[model samples]
Target: MSSGTSNGEHRYVIIGNGIAGTTAAEHIRKADGAASIKLLTNEPHPLYNRIALPPFLKQKIARQKVTIHNEAWHAERNIDLMLEQTAVRVDPLAREVYLASGATLPYDTLLIATGGRANPLPNANGLQNVFNFQTLDDSLAILAQIERSESAVVIGGSYISYELTEAFRSRGLQTTWLMRGPRFLRRVLEAEGGALVDRIAGRHGVQVIHGVEIAEVRGQDGKVSEVVTSDGRVFPCQLLGVGVGITRNVDFLAGSGIETSSAVLTDQCLRSNVPGVFAAGDSAEYYDPYVGHPILMGTWDNATNHGKIVAQNMLGGEVPYDDVPTYSTTLFHNRIMAFGATPESNPDVEAVMWLDEASESYRRLFFQGERMVGGVIIGQRKGFPKLIDLIKQRTPIPVAEREQVLAQSVQ
Candidate 1:
């Protein structure tokens, strides 16, 4: 056995360096002090708060403040972090992970916390100022481009596109927000909330175009200049921000005995069908005890809590992960939050919504029968805690009184 391992100790290997993987490593060290832990990531930097990248990209905060756990912090925790190491393949039979550098790591228990990669626009070949806003590096490159570029085109109606729009607009760029949807956040937000986002974009001089596809990216002197939409509408832009969505990174798990779908399938305890192997974070489609179904949550708190629950289960604890996943973000000027299952997530659930058009504030509460299932809140955040509690406790509020309940809380 390697000197890192002892007779009674087992080697634990974790892939990826996001909050989920890093949090699991920290908890495992505290729970099983003697277990050998190895953490690997393609990123050179230590675990950082990716959620803070919005303000970082906007230049509202310094780069130093975005970092969470540093190298020395991981060292003090005794986590053997292998930076810039890419896992090329996994062998379930031999229980080994083959690195791109021709190295192999053997593990008794493995956690594939490998997250998702930002989906890119088609035909965006090596174009200058075209970026998918996801990582710190992507944000840094975008910030550098904003220093010289103006009049940018943002694609997609997702959160990343809004963040890119916010960053570019804050930098005094003439921004044009384009998407193939009717309004912003078409999949999650109700009509009032989405229209409020469009209004927010318009308030800042952002041209919000919907139901259009990118036909071509025209360049001038080897640099981006304008974009041609499929509808033949041409918009002049110097930068292109693509935030279509993310493709979960699970290609390395093929033939590794790990079942896969849109994400890695895990039970209520976050365990894979494969013994001694597990998955978490954005790539994990864990069975939700609250909803009584499998769900893929890509929120910071859900992933962080997944780390703790998975670690406990990895160490033989029967702790099931449970929480009403909430993803909160800002679009231009509106603070948008989605808690539990929205109408898009569960269309069968009934919805009660109130729109304060004067204030541009919107609140939506989703219910199943008499029990609160989930909700989406836009502009107002003060009553989010109560909505979450209603979902968690499955509070029974009659459909007739649903609006009254939401009204009282917001009031």
Candidate 2:
């Protein structure tokens, strides 16, 4: 198949309407006015804010507020919006995408942004009151269940689990946080960091048990009633929130020759091994030039930036993604911020840490040689912006000045 149509106009087909794919579609329309753009998503609704779902669950925001774009928005830009269409196969050689609905789409350049599916756990299948908090629909169903729930159990140790913990506690549900790992963010934060999180959750009246896995869930009347752990302990609850992890949606590319490890493997340009095929968002594990390795960051900011950069590259620009990725969110009443590479993601880097139990604050800086690569700050936000600048510029800090930098950052 030819790359372009008979008249030379380009065809762009993007899968997944998350921030990554949607942003790419928006920018592509801006740059190439005449390009035929088709945006696809398996979801039934238009583009919505996944980040806001937590707040919506807490009744801080209305359901409609979570939506970022309406169908009319795509119509205004003359972009074809295809919803509830799951791409089942990709014929990269023929530049065609086969959908589950028996529809075929041909593209000159294709962007695979089908983000991910929530990883399911055993006993969660076909079970009522057991939920995965990954989508707007999940959150909505959870919100409805919360109205009838008196107790909640949150599983996993990732950010999603933390969000579930906070939401349940905020709603006055007797909440129990369960994790197989010893602590939260086990890979990124140390024991002291985990203790801080425990203290925060405790202050909010949350029961946190660690190093235990879910053995079996006991239900009554087709609804979850209690959970039994591997250690043979049982905790009664009306709702279960599972945030184990996510499986990147790349199964359709199984034989399409798209190189994938944890996700679609792309270079700094966000281009897959095959020409004219690109990836973005959580689906793309692109090589990070700054970190000197391939990394997958699934933050909204990272995905949004990926869309912008990938759009330029898909339009024949050789631009490489260089944005510094950062994530900042509120935990209970405190702030948790992390940016760039961390000890969890890159073990080769050396780390320095400081903690103050009285103030409930902690800071850890990661260094490679003399340059600051990444850092995590919990509690205070005094020097977060400065640290981002230092990492972005690759500023060098001498060993003698390392402690001084940390002390001054908090002030």
The models' CA-based lDDT, in order, is 0.85, 0.90
Cα lDDT, model 1, residue 141: 87
Worst 10 residues of 1 by lDDT: 1-10
Residues 47-122, candidate 1, lDDT per residue (tens digit)?
9899999999889999999999889998898999999999988887788899999999998888989889999898
RMSD of each: 2.1, 1.5
Query: Model 2 off-target regions past 4 Å?
Result: 1-3, 399-401
Model 1 accuracy (lDDT, Cα): 0.85
Residue 16 accuracy (lDDT) in model 2: 95
lDDT per residue, candidate 2, 1-411, as tens digits? 244787777999999999999999999999989899999999998899999988998989998899999999999998899999999999989999999999999999999998988888777646799999999989989999999999999999988899999999999999999999999888778899999999999999999999999999989988999999989999999999999988899998999998999899999999999999999999999998667898888788999999999999999999999977888788899988778888666878777888989988999888778888888889878888888888888788997788887888888
